[model samples]
Target: MLQSDRAEAAEAAAVIETQCPFCSVQCKMTVTEGGKGIPGQRRAEYKVEGVPNAASEGRVCVKGMHAHQHAVHSQRLTHPFIRSNGELVPCSWDEAFAVARQHLQGISEQHGPDANAVYGGGSLTNETAYLLGKFARVALGTRYIDYNGRFCMSAAASAGSKTFGIDRGLTFRLADIPLARCIVLAGTNIAECQPTLLPYFNQAKENGAKIIVIDPRKTATAAMADMHLPIRPGTDTILADAMLKIIMDEGFIDETFIQARTNGYDELSVYLNSLDLSQAADICGLELEQIREAALAYGEADTGMVLTARGVEQQTDGHLAVRHFLNLVLATGKIGREGCGYGAITGQGNGQGGREHGQKADQLPGYRSIESEKDRAYVASVWGVEAATLPGKGVSAYEMMELIHQGVIKSLFVMGSNPIVSNPNAGLVEEGLNKLDFLMVADMFMSETARMADLVLPVTSYMENEGTLTNLEGRVLLREAGRQAPGEARHDWMILCSMADMLGKGHYFRFHEPEEIFNELRLASKGGIADYYGISYDRLRREKGVYWPCPSPEEAGVGLLFQQSFAHPDGKALFSIMEGDPWKGVSEEYPLILTNGRVLSHYLTGVQTRRSPSLLARELENFVEIHPITAQRYRIRDGEWVEAQSEHGCFTVRARIKDQIREDTLFVPMHWGGVQNVNHATRPDLDPFCKMPGFKTSAVRIRPLHQKVYRENDSYTER
Candidate 1:
């Protein structure tokens, strides 16, 4: 029996402690199964309340309170389905498996293994994410496997690896934020997405810490800052380099830390000598004095903190943006001590762990490059396969859609992602899906992407499964299964294992439970950067949670990293020279910059949150947030329909004019999908190094449509 089932059978406790299934905060909460009709059968009576755990500290957001709807939503997939004559109909599991295997094998034999691929979600647990990679490489023999996290955390991961030899999001704990003398929040909206973490920043402010926020708009988080640097979109690197120059000119450079712990300072200094703040001020749309004051406050602080998110990491030079920000943290010696660190605010629940364990296209079991022969051999030995047989590195997430459009990839298996709504350039994704010879999806609901799949397999949710997840702080957490999967829904392990058996790869996938898969994963990840051999379900429960790089069971998880030496063999961090690049996304026809982000009431793609009446009542549709001056230029009015047109495509949404944003910029929520999708107006251009799409930067022009176009019973995802 499952652990939760065993506990309930014994009546040990009425409420079970579990982690929230939404954002990376992973707030710990208690769930009780009571006042239900056969608890977990037809309906689940889950009462969720926050606990005083490490991440949230007894604070629950609206999403966590309503997360109980995932199991009992009206449109949840209750059985396996297959496309019959252009219509999806209910089918038996055996028929679904037979169809999936026949198409996958036929596609491989006809075109090659590269023609088949796997696209996964960052919300999956570490165990499920690991097995998804293995299933692609071993069962299907495909090299093109990547997850949706490429759109969120790839740039930050690349920058962290290049600078410090490892990427673990936060090097320290969230609890340490209160001790910092200064904190810089760049391109992250903490007040809306991670409301639970605001307490830490609030405590830092209460302790007399100065907070500086950088973004194009004066967001709610920015409104409370000591200084707000309202910058132009795609100018993150420009501002960071300017700050480094100011810190050096003001005599705040830590020469001792530079000489002892890092390299490449002289080259950076030489590059800084050529900086022009006057021109930078014009490009960044900020007053020169605001920039200087913000830099001085942080440089003069005894200790500093820097936290970056999607705003800076979604541009064409995203990797360089993150690297430039790291320059400030390293040059000021603001790391490896109390109240001093750098981290990326991961957006998804398992975004950190998902990228660490083989979900990335070019990564192995433990964040090791697939092109490295040593890494290949070590991982092959763990999987009981020959190193020569393993596939090499593949393309990234957005490039997979390009491959499908180019006819190089014909079949795809997506697990728990709604790319039709989530991926940028919606037209390109829709076209690629139309060209696919076979497409299968595993999800609990018919998401926008699942609606186009050739086969849809019913899968379980976090409330119905038990596995471990790593949060943004590198802490590995255990999430307990609080209820059973209703109807014919099954765990991802069971579905994958049965499919492997049908494909004649049963020997490699003989796992009966999630723990068995995690055990094997622990062995595979023994020597890699994210070394998780020390993490186990038992240890997780005992310690509450533990950070990664725990190489042995006798050793505790290392929450504090880089005390003396960096992860490199030479015991020194590498400082990348900041590059000055130009962003010419705006043209005469499209005179304004466009940015899309999440709203306070809804989650990604609105696949799960849209199902809840409470969340929908709070936010029924995405709106176009524009500056009043920008709105007046186009003669647009607030609460009216407006068409935002770009070179890619266009969409009409309600216009909401406000003075909180730049006059030359526009903002839109990225939750709604289908015809109301905002991603249709964004470019699919990728950062050359990290392969991250420019989801936050686009060029567009807005015009009021002068009418509201809607039907009484309009549908989007189900359509």
Candidate 2:
């Protein structure tokens, strides 16, 4: 078993408080030790209770309540595995490490460092992410490094940095939600994706705040909104442009604030003037009055906020879409004040902090650009390495996979991600994995991606590991270890450190504890945008949580950013000029638009959540949500099996005929992989600026299945 401070016999049964490891909400919870347990043999059973926190306020989602179950689940990986004769078999840790080192070194020596790459996950702690990036650049000497955050919130980060010079996922705290006069939540279903946040919206509603939801379907969150503008899929930019045009036409533009705190207003005005609301309305399939009403409600409010999610940030023009959405906030002067600002709703645990560290392909610690010589020099000094030794910026998540398929990236190291099920095109990703000369994966479970690795290492889950996670509001909370890890399972950081030692880079990675790495991270991030120089593990435990930009101990963490000035050189935000058709037209063969999203019961890829019997009972299988008109045209009945096909691939799922969606669009949940994987049909078209795959929109056709069938290769359920 993994080592930990043994609890006293009397204290072993006491309750321990920790943060949920699921979504970015990071709700606090108290886990009570229940069943009888051995001293160092096995972990005790846990009963979870919601604990009060700044974000959740004593509320927890179903997923969070049952999170402890997965830590000691029967399916948890407890030992290392090495491929032998086309099958993975149990192996000693030393043998596994030796094999991995041999293959990695051979590949690097033959093909150079560029041929090896590392793909990380957004769920990792700030310290793990920092070290992983350092390991990839300094130890591996490879420039190819990126994380799953590329698919989560890279668009928002790119747009926020370009506009305001910094990105923190949110500008204010979650407690401020109820104080706004109006909130425009575009393309996000917070009610389901983040159930604990619904109470904040409810409080806002009780305070007479008008809520406007912009989405193609009437989601659970939309049902509670004052108005739901069910625009056509991928028309977010057009609708946003129309709203801006109306706001300008009605003289709602805050000229004084614009002149004082922003630049490029003339460029924005010219673009707004060129947009025709009537034409945009036609293109978006919404009445012109609906657009005007949304614009009026948002602009007329004394204090309003705007938020976007994967629905808008996963498109080809995701960055442009975010920039145009911010125009509404800038025009109305609704930012940098109490309960007023624009931000992206981060989806993954530590999504905000993960990107701030050096995990992205083009970023260093503290959100510094890797291409900047000054930034590189600063980071190099912290690592005690020559600045010129660090490799430059590399390709993104999808691009790295493509390189693997082409034999350009000969070896890959994956941590905390299941790309086979989570990536845009599963077939393509699997082919790339098969083409790799060496593949190493470290995860708590034997995930689909892990199954393909030449060597798989077992790692501890959140409940059994101690680290820190940054919530969506940019609040960093300590995730205390409440239980012991199962046999032979180590923390991801410990495993990385051991691997670094085996690879002849032991001098650089001398971390014996998470806090040691965290201290180094604080120093590396001292002067950058996400400065955490003064933050410490002791401080986090004492304060429960602290926001970023905490430069000193005397000053309280910054809960609200840009109260007086922006992060730009001139202390002003920029208005980006947007130009493009937001919509990708439907073809004659594929006559409908396919939109995919997450469900309440399951998290991304359903790797851990699906293991919980409670969650699995709620959402047992995947299904396509089709409008009544589309179902009638295809002769598909409610709960009938149907095959959805796109130009890339096809998958079969049951159709749930409902009127909540638009007639021309079909909705599918993206949590399922294996035979029911919707990503099989998802196109690999990526946003040029951010490299985010277009998982939201695809052109596809559906037909009723004549016979009851299940794909023979469906392996997700077997676990």
Candidate 3:
């Protein structure tokens, strides 16, 4: 039985403990049921309380405190909907499934199985993600299966895999944060984005740890740092190279550790010799002394760590930029030890587990490549299918959308993600969606993307589901279903099962519970990098969480990876060679550099958070931040309406004048959609290695809006 089912079967406990479904921190929370007669019925009213766990210690964010509000909101989708004559009307489950199956089969018969694709979300539990990938490949017989996580941390994953031969979010635990003598936070405003993690940094600060924040603006996180390197947009690679050059100049290289722990030092040293600190400083628009001081502080520390976020990972050179940061850690030999390692802060709830368990287009479960014949044979055996029946690798998420725009992918199945608001080039994505022959979305609410679908399937929220999620620290925690799904809404796993049955693949997808699927996952990942063979739901209950690579039942999971040697075949970490050329520069027509980020009150795309009254009250609309000098140059005042135009598109938002950002840069939140969508102005240029979009930096021009367009109370008329 599932852990949630087991928990519900217990009659004594009124409050059930589960992990929060927002962000990668996975903060533990207890749901107190009120006036409960039966476990799943009796008009379940709920409240959230913080529970101590490996990721968070009894601390919940404002969003977590109110996450339950949207689950039972009046506007939540309770039944399936089918579009007829340009209007969405409630329909029966059988009719909706029939329509979906008909279109899926028709599309495949007409244009082959390659014409159909599946796009999923990072918020899905490991079991659902694994089954979704299986459904797409086996039931639909389609090769195109990818998730929204490609945009979140793929660059870091690609870099980490190439450098260390394995890609887990963090090599060490969160408890090690306070033990590090120095930490460099690159492109992450953890104070607002992941507030539950702020206490760790606070503890680190209390212990005299030096915090160096690298960002383009003086965010809430940067304000608390010992030193903030306000870098120019898209110059992360240049800044990283300059820091390495400075470290070498100060003779801070650990020769003994280098000889004992890593490889490729000679090649990296030759490349570092070609880089000039002054040139990099000029390119990054930062002072040489600032770079030197930051490098000295990090290099001089006995044990230090580097953490990258969406800022560095959303660039055209994202993979290379991440590799540059890894090079710094390798040079200082501060890895594979307590309080020292390189990590990428995963943004979504199950971004880590979702990617590890076969959601990506190019990977199988256990972080194995789909292209490997051995991996295919092993996974095929586990699924009771012939190895040759598996389809070939498909494109990334953005590439899949492009194919849809070109009429290659005739049908699409979207689950848990609202790509119309979240994907890069939002206007183009919507246009592509309109061109699809058939589009279906499964979500808890009628999201912006769901409104565009031909058929919309109502699915239960995280509170009404049971599964496991891997946090940013690689710890796997259980998420229990606290209440019954309202109305006709079903769990995503059940929905997938029903769809598989309708497609005549019920024999392969015959699991009746989530635990059944999870057991299969354990077998599939027995000998892989993200091995979860030893972890069972019962074990997870006894221990709050367990890290991966627990190969045997008697062996406890390892909190710190690569303690003795790196995962590479040679047992040595590799350093990346830095690139000298700067990223694409700004053109005269679009002189200012425009960047985007998230807000504390609003999660990605604002599909769920915006529906909550509390979160909406905190941040109702989007605004762009411009330096005082830039605002003055554009003849725009604070709260004045302005149009930011890039080569891709233009968006209008209120201007907030501040000197925190660079004079030539502007900042906008990535939450609002439609006319307020910042992604409309973002370029779709992707990293060559990981296919991550360059959402962090785009060249644009700012012009004050017409007087009539500006409204009172610091708001602008929506276009």
Q: Could you tell me which 10 consecutive residues in candidate 2 have the lowest summed lDDT?
A: 1-10
Global lDDT scores for all candidate models: 0.89, 0.89, 0.89
Q: Which scores higher on lDDT, 1 or 3? A: 3
Off by over 4 Å in 3: 1-14, 33-46, 578-580, 707-719
Q: Write the per-residue lDDT of candidate 2 for residues 1-719, one digit (tens) a residue.
A: 22343344334575777778888999999988754544554556667889888889999898998887777689999999999999999999999989988988898899998998999999999989999999999889999999998999999999999999999899888988999989999989999999999998899999999999999999999999999999888888888889988988999889999999999899889877878778999998999999899999998899989999999999888888998898888878889899899879999998999999898999999888899999999999999999999999999999998899899999999999998888888789989999998899999998889999999999999877888888999888888886688989999999989988999998899999899999999999989999988799999989999998899877688988899999999999998786856766589999899989999989899899988888899999999999998898988999878989899898888999999999999999988888899999999989888888888889999988763354678532211
**Reference-based lDDT, residue 293, model 1:** 94
The residue pairs that clash in candidate 2, if any, are: none
Off by over 4 Å in 2: 1-14, 37-45, 707-719
Candidate 1's displacement at residue 142, Å, is 0.5
The residue-level lDDT of candidate 1 at 56 comes to 90
User: Per-prediction TM-score, please?
Assistant: 0.95, 0.96, 0.95
Off by over 4 Å in 1: 1-16, 37-46, 707-719
Q: After superposition, how far is residue 484 of candidate 3 from its true place, in Å?
A: 0.4
